[model samples]
Target: MEQRELGFTKIRLPVVGQGTWQMEEADEAACIDAIRRGIDAGMTHIDTAEMYGAGEVESLVGKAIEGRRDEVFLVSKVLPSNASYAGTLAACERSLERLRTDRLDLYLLHWPGSEPLEETLRAFKDLRAQGKIRHFGVSNFDQAELSRAIALAGPSEIACNQVFYHLLERAIEHRVLPLCERHGIAVVAYSPFGSGRFPAPDSMGGKVLASIAAAHGATPRQVALRFLLRRQPVFVIPKAARAAHALDNAAAGDLRLTSEDLARIDTAFPLGPDRGVLPTL
Candidate 1:
C-alpha cells in the first residue's frame, strides 16, 4: 500500500484505511478479522468512533490490534454532544479504555454541535500536551465551520477533516477540499463506495466505471477508491466487515487509473459546482 503524510504531520497513512461504522457486538469476531486482514495488507490506518456501535466497534478494534499495535495508525472520534471541554476529556479516556491504547494517532470531533469551538479545541490541546492524542481534527465540517475551526485551533492543530466524499458526492471539491489543501489539512474520505449504495456495474454511471475497471482488472469499488487516492493528501476509509472485502479494499491502493479513464469518469459523474450544505450522519 502507498503512504502519504497526514496534513503537515510526520505521520504517514495508507491512502485506503479501514472504517468501523456499524460494526456491532454480534459481528465482533468478523469485525476483528476484517481489521486484522486490512492491517496485514498494510492498511494500517484504522478509523472508528465512540458513537460506532456505542463504542462496541472500538472494543473490537482493540482486540484486533492487541499484539500488533505498533503497526496501526489508530483514529477515533468523540460525539458532538460530548464536545465540551470536560466532556471531551472524559470521552477520550473512555475511548482509550475501549481501544486499549494509551494514545490515539488522531482524535476527531464527530460533528458540529452546541459546544463552543474554543472549549473543544482547548481540550484537544490539553490532550495533545498530555500525550493522550497525537493529533486532533473534525469530521463533517463544511467550509465555513472548517475555517472557523482553523481560526480557533490554528492551522497546524487541525490534522485532517473527514468528510463524505466519492464520485457521486463531489460537493467538497468546490471549496472544502481546496480550503483544506491551502491550510495543509488532510482529507479523510468516508463512504467512498457511497455507503454500499453505489450504482450497479451495468447502470449508466457503472458502465463507465466498469470500462475503467476492465482496463485495470479491478472492481468498481477499487476504481472508485483509486480515483480518491490519486488526489494527493486525501485518504479513503471504506467499511469492510469481511476479510475478503477488506483485502480487496486495501488492494485498491495499488490500482492506478489513467488520465483518460479519469476524464471519462468525470464526464459520467459530472462534478456539481454547488458547494451546497455539507451532509452529515
Candidate 2:
C-alpha cells in the first residue's frame, strides 16, 4: 500500500483509514474487534469525533488502542458549536480525557461555525504549543473558510481537511481541491462509497468500477475507495464493523486503476456538473 506524508508531519498515513462516527453506540467488544482487524489489515489512521454519541466513540477507540496507540495516527475533533477559543480548548481537553491520551496525532475542528475562525484556530495553535496535539486540521470546511484560517493561523501546517468526496458528491473539486493544492494540504475523503447509496453501476461511481472490480474479483467498495486514493494523495475512510467489510475496503490499495478506467469514472461522474451536484467534499 502506498503512503503519503500528512502535510509536513513525519507520519506517513496510509491510503485507507477507519472511520468511527457510525460506531458510536456499537457494542464494546464488537467495536474493539473491528478496530483490531483494521489495524491488523495495515490501516494506520483512525478518525473519531466528540459529538459522536456524546464522546462514546472516542472512549471506545481509546479502549481499543489500549497498548497500541503508538502504532496508529489517532484523530479526533471538537464539534462545530465549540468554535470559541475557550470552548475549543475545553473540548480538546475533554477529548484527551475520553481518548485516554496525553497527546493526539491529529485534532480537528469539526466544521465551520458561526464563531470567529481565529478563535477556533487560536485554540488549535495553543494546544499544539502545549504539546497536547501533534497536528491540527479541520473537517467540513469549504475552500474559502480554509484559506481564511490558513491566513490567520500564520505559517502553521494544516494537516488534513476531511469532507465528503465521492462520485455522487464531487463539489470539493471546484472549491476545495485547488486551494488545498496551493497550500499543500492533504484531503481526507469520507463516504467514498457514496454513503451506502447505489453501490456501483446504478450510482454515480458508474460501471467502470464494476468492470474493474470484476477483473480483480474485488467488490465495488474497494474500487470506489481506490478511485479516491488515485486522485490527489487523499486518505479514504470508509466505515465498516465487520471484518469482511473492512478487508474489502483495504484491498483497494492492492489494485491500481488504469487511465482508461479513471477516465470512464470521471466521465460518468464529472466534477462540476450542474445537474448532478454532489453534496460536499
Candidate 3:
C-alpha cells in the first residue's frame, strides 16, 4: 500500500485504512474477522471512536488487534461532549481500557465542542507526554475551527483532520483542504463512499465510476477511494464490516487512476460551489 506522512510528523500511514463506524450492527465474529483481514491486507490504520456503539466498537477493535497491536496504527476519537480538559483525559483512559491498549497511535477530538479548545489541547499535550497517545488531531472541524486548533496546538502538533469527503461532498476542497495542505496536516477522508449514500452502479456518477473502474480492472468503490487519494497528502478510511468488503477496500490502495479517468470523474461529480456548509459529525 502507498504511504503518506501524518501532518509534518515522521510517522507515515497507509493511503487506505479501515473505518469501524457501524460495524457494531454486524455480526461480532464477522466484524472482528473483517478487521483482521483488513490488517493482514495492509490496511493497518484502524480507526474507531468512543461514541461508536457507546464504546462497544472499540472493544471489538481491541479483540481484532489483540496480539497484532504492534502491527497496526490505532486511532480513536473522544466525543465532543468529552472535550473538556478533565473529560478528555478521562475519556481517553476509558477508550484505552476498552481498546485493551496502553497507547493510541492517534487520538482526535471528535468535533468542535463547547469546551475551550486550549483545555482539550492541553490534555492532548499531556497525553502525548505521558505516552498515552503518539499524536493528536481533530475531526469535522471547519476552516476557522481548524485554524484555531492549529494556533492552539501548533501545526506540527496537530496530525490530521478527519472529515467527510466524497464525490458528493467536496466543500472542504474550498478552504479546509488548502489549509491542511499548507500546514502539512494529512486530510483523513472518512466516508469516502458517502456514508451509505454511494451511487448505484446504474446511476450517472456511478456509471462514470464504473467505467473508470472497469478500465483499471477495479471496483467503483476502489475508484471512489483512489479519487480521494489522488492528492499527495490524503488518507481514506472506508468501513467494511464484511471480510470481502474489507479485502476489496484494501485493494484500492494499489489502484491508480489515469488523468483521463480523473477528468471523467470530475465531470461526472463536479465539486459544486462551496456554500460554507460542513457535513454533520
Candidate 4:
C-alpha cells in the first residue's frame, strides 16, 4: 500500500486505512475479521472514536489487533463532551482500557466543545509527556476554529485534521485544505463513500466512475477511493465491516488513475458551492 508522511513527522501512515465508524452495526465476528483482513492487506491505520457505539467499537478493535498490535498504527478520538483538560485525561485512560493498549499512536479532539481549547491541548501535551499518546490533532473543525486551534497549539504540535471529504462535498477545498497544507498538517478524509449514498448506476457521475473503473479494471468503489488520493497530504479511512470489502478497499491503494481519468471525474463530480461549513458526522 502507498504511504504518506503524517504532518511534518517522520511517521508515515498508509494512504488507505480501515475506519470503524459503524462497525458495531455489523456482525461482531465479521467486523473483527474485516479489521484483521485489512491489516494483512496493509491497511494498518485503524481509526475509531469513543463516540462510536459508546466505545464498543474500540473494544472490537482491541480484539482485532490483539497479538498483532505492533503491526498497526492506532488512532482514536475523544468526544467533545469529554475534551476538558481533566476529562481528556480520563477519556484517554478509558479508551486505552477499552482498546487493550497502553498508548495511542495519535489522539484527537473529536470536535470543538464547551471546554477551553487551551485546557484540552494542555492535556494532550501532558499525555505526550507521559508517553500515553505520540501526537494529537483535531476533527470537524471549521476554518475559524481550526485557525484558532492551530494558533493555540502551534502549527507543528497539531498533527492532522480529520474531516468529511468525498466527491460531492468539497467545501474544505476553499480554506481548510490550504491551511493544513501550509501548516504541514495531514488531512484525514472520513466517510469517503458519503455514508453509502453512492450515485445510482444510471446517473452521469455513476457512468463516469464506471468508465474510469473499467479502464483501470477496478470497481466504482475503488475509483472513488482513488480519486480522493490524487493529491498529497490527503488520505482516507473508509469503513469496511466485512473482509471482502476491506480487501477491496485496500486494493485501491495500488490504483494509479491517469490525468485524463482525473479530469473526467472532476467534470462528472464537480465541486458544489463552498458553503463555508466543513461537513462533520
Best by lDDT: 4
Error of 4 at 271 (Å): 1.1
In order of lDDT, best first, we have 4, 3, 1, 2
Q: What does the lDDT come to for candidate 1? A: 0.90
* Shift in Å, residue 182, candidate 4: 0.3
lDDT of 1 by residue, 1-281 (tens): 88889988968788899988888844778888989989999899999999998988899899999999889999999999999999999999999999999999999999899999899999999999999999999999999999999999976889999999888888888889999899889999998888767978778899988888988889888998888777787999999888999999988988888899888888888887785788655
Question: lDDT for every model?
Answer: 0.90, 0.80, 0.92, 0.92
Stretches of model 1 off by over 4 angstroms after superposition: none
Q: What is the lDDT of residue 99 in candidate 2?
A: 88
Q: Tens digit of lDDT per residue, candidate 3, span 1-281? A: 88877778768888999999988898999999999999999999999999999999999999999999999999999998999999999999999999999999999999888999999999999999999999999999999999999998875888999999998888889999999999988899998998878989889999999898888899999999998888877899999989999999999999988899989988898998878867864
Q: Residue 214 of candidate 1: its Cα lDDT?
A: 86
Give lDDT tens digits, candidate 2, residues 96-209.
999889989889988888888888888888999999998898888786778877888765478778988886677878767767777778889887776766454665555667
lDDT score of residue 59 within candidate 1: 90
Tens-digit lDDT track of model 4 for 190-239: 99988877877789999999989998899999999999888787999999
After TM-score superposition, the amount by which residue 10's alpha carbon in candidate 1 deviates from its true location, in angstroms, is 2.7
Candidate 1 vs candidate 4: which has greater TM-score? 4
Worst 10 residues of 2 by lDDT: 272-281
**lDDT score at residue 95, model 2, on the 0-100 scale:** 91
Q: Which stretches of candidate 4 lie over 4 Å from their true place?
A: none
